[model samples]
Every structure is written in structure tokens, then in C-alpha cells.
Target: MVLQQRREPYPHWEYTDPSGAEVLRVVPERGGLVTGWSSLGRDWLYFDAERFADPDLSVRGGIPVLFPICGGLPDGRLPLPQGVFTLAQHGFARDRAWELSALEGGDGVRLTLAHDPHTLAAFPFLFRLSLEYRLAPGQLGITAQVANAGEDPMPFSFGLHPYWAVDDLSAVRLEGLPAEGFDHHTMAPATLAAQLEALGEGVDLLAHPAGPVRLRGVAGGAAVTLEPDAPLDLVVLWTDPPRPMVCLEPWTAPRGALISGDRRLLVDPGGCCSLSCRYRVDRGWG
Candidate 1:
């Protein structure tokens, strides 16, 4: 009737809210990624165990944390005031090990990652990030906090990439998208509907909608709704056919935010910003 927290085998911490009918698997060492989320006896996330088990590969599934930069910089280099630093795509947050601990009520877990010598060598900034995850009934929530620990302002973009499970990619009915969006592959304007139709061939597009996004017709008969807080409402839809997974992600900025400074946010010294989002489930929405 309460909740439970247990360390599973290597690198995984399990959190289950028995009262809420939800279960989650967290891997602090794997970018604080939520490798699994289950509700109402059905798994809502897609995970690739093989890639996840290998430390040298970028995880194909689960929710990978994106920070400092969402996409990539020119030639994989970032020119800062101090000097030019080599940062790979999506920055180093997703590759670093995080410190994990249970929340005060034992109802959730907090995973924290801070800058170290290795990160400083690439990012040249003093920063700290905290991710808190909690579940209740038919809902799962996450609160991400970023602090600027350096003397100067910190420019950054943050995002979460969640791979949702879907047996038939064509049956995925996603609503609440604007009419137009940007295609990641082509870098051209496109209609969101067209992208959904091409799911079988593979689709990657980003859109910004005002209200909650409704996702239905997954493998199971259940429905999911993503509710993201302000400034983090940018939605990106991606699919790799034959994998049975579709990623409906929330981002604070589009690709190249840091490079172009478009919608990029800056946190002043000693200041912190908090962003929160939640996902709710329902039945028979198909």
C-alpha cells in the first residue's frame, strides 16, 4: 500500500509505488536514465537491453538525459570565452555517472550529477543537475533542476528523450501538435501529419504545441498524455521502424540552441532553474 526501493543487479535502482500501480527502474550510472516504467500491468517504455548493458554504446531506448546542449555543435566543438572545448552530441551528462538517493518520503528518487575534472575539460563550466522522479496512481512525474555554480552565466539547453513502446508504428495516433514542424534529417519545414504517416519508413520531427499532447493506439489499448511545464513544451517525435518504439520527447529548446542562442536560457551565478513534467495514463482512448 506504500512504496518500495531496492537496488537491483549492477547499476540499477528499482522504485515501485504499490499503491499507485506503477513501477520504475532507474540507472544512475546510465545518465540517470529511467529504463522502464510500468503502470496498470503494462510497460509504457521501450528498452534495448543489449545496448544498455554495453558501456561503450549510446543507449537506444529508455529516457536519456540531455543537458548543456541538446544536439551537437559545429565540428563537435564549442567555442567558449575560456577556450574551445570538444563536446560530443548531447553533451556529457548522458555519459556520466550520477549519485542516486531516495527522497525524504521514500516515495521517489533523486539522481544528481555535477561537473568534475573530466566534464570541465570539455564544458569549462561549474554546474550541477538534479533529477527527481515520483509516481502516483496513473501518473509519473519528473522534476529537473540545474544550478549555475560558476562565476559567470551558464548557457544551456535541457531535454528528456523517452522511448515509448508501440507494436505497430502506423497505429500511433499523436495529437496536440502544431500544423508545421522542422524535420531533423532535412532541416526543412514540414507538416507534422505527414511525418506520422511515414512512421513505417522512420520519422523524426519537432513541433511546439500549446496544450497537453495525447498519445494513443500503442501496442496495448491504453493511452498516454504528456504534460510539460512552460519553456519545456517543445515536442519531438521519432521512430525507428521494426524496433516497435516511438520517442515523444519534451525539450526546452530545439537543436543548436547553444550554437545559435535561439531560445537558449542562461542561469546566472548562484542561480538555479527548475523544470517539471508529468505523464498520465488512461484506457480505451484508441
Candidate 2:
């Protein structure tokens, strides 16, 4: 493995395989975001560097870490036993900076996020989040560890929103997802297939695959299969067409799970919870 620093365009850590067939670039200050990834002679991630240049905008591409909560709360308020806290959509981990370090005696990188004043103000808990990222010939794997450093058990949800590049949105198809799901567009239950067919508009729905999900592009394009670990197997499908991209997000719980107490995961005090997921890529229509 070869690790180098690239300053142009932006400051990020670039790691590559000796074979030079795989590459990954990450920006720690940007929520430990994976800005770009390439394998099998093709770029798998869709990154909007133009928008990324502006600091005020939320990242439109790359893999954004969702933590503490999967989605927004009622009026951005989380009524915990401690008190009522204002937690934004997807929590604050994705917006705050993270510390990045090379894996010790390993072949990848590790990014760590600890509790800060801002986070405590929102979630009111001391926690540590460590993410280890690695790459192979045609795959990317991530292992996430969340530790509750406080004296009380912490209730939270975790997820990863990865924007994948494609040749054509209309030509993309995903297998292994449930046939029905809640559509965020209309805020109603709808068929998953029909939601995906609206290429001109967009899609934002959570599908409970409860396992792995496979996505394929047009002929001669890219194919990706996402296999998430238990408690994080649900997939959120999203796309804003005309950009040739789609986001297959793996989530630990459905939106509003924290308040609804539906499938919400908890970490005991002084205990850590570990989860993992993998993405395998290739070239093919199906």
C-alpha cells in the first residue's frame, strides 16, 4: 500500500494499492468523508468538488457518515431523559471535523471522532466514534466502532450515505430490495419500482432489505453490491437525476427510529458497539 498527501484541489489523504488498480481519498476535517474512490479502472464515487469548495453547503457526493440519529427529529428536538436537545438532521458528526491517522501496522486508515462541546450540546453524551477504512482489488470495507464514554447507556442510530457514480440513471437497477417502501417525496407508502422509474425527478425512500443490496448500471458501466452488517442492513435509495449518480445508504435504523423506539440500538455505559459493511464493484449491466 502506498499513502501520499495531495494538496491541490483540496487537502486529503490518498491511499492506493501497490497494483495501482484501487485508490481512496479522504478528508478528515469534512466529517472523515471519503471524497473519492476508484477500482476496476473506474471511479465508483460521485463527488461534487465544485459544491464541496463552498464550506456552507452540505456535501452532495461522497460517503457522509450519519450518526447518533439516522434522520431528523421533530422540530430538531430530541427529548432525552437528560433534557430536550436540538439535534439536526442526521446529527452533527457529519458536519464536525474528525481526526485521521494511518492504521498502525495495518493496510488502511482510521478516523476518529470524539465528543466535543457542540456534540454534547446536541446529544448530551460523551462518546467516541472510530471508523476504519480499507480497500482491495474491487472492494471497500468499513468498520465502525461507537463507544459510550459516559456513565449512562446511549441510545443512537448509525448510517452511511454513499453517492455512487453511474453512466445513466435510467439504466440502473437494484435487486434484493423490498417491493414496497415509504416514499419521502410524497410522504406516503408507494411501490419501490415505480419510485425508481421517475428518473427525470428524483428518489428518496428507505428500503428494508435487511441484508445486501445489488446495483447495476448500463452496459459497459459499473456495478456495485452493498452488504451491510446486522443492525445496519437497511438501504436508503436516493437520486437527483441529470447527474448520473445514486446514493445507496445503509442505515442502522429507519428514520425517526430514535423517537419511535423502533429498532433503535443502544450502547451500554463504558461499552462499545461495532458494526461493519462492504461494497464490491465490477463492470456489467446486471
RMSD score of candidate 1 (Å): 1.9
User: Which residue pairs clash in candidate 1?
Assistant: none
lDDT of each: 0.84, 0.86
Per-residue CA lDDT of model 1 for 63-85, tens digit only, reads 99998888778899888788888
Candidate 2 clash pair list: none
Local distance difference test, candidate 2: 0.86
Question: In TM-score terms, which candidate is top?
Answer: 2
Q: Per-residue CA lDDT of candidate 2, range 164-206, in tens?
A: 9887887888888899987877878889879778854898998
Off by over 4 Å in 1: 1-11, 18-20
Question: Which prediction has the highest lDDT against the true structure?
Answer: 2
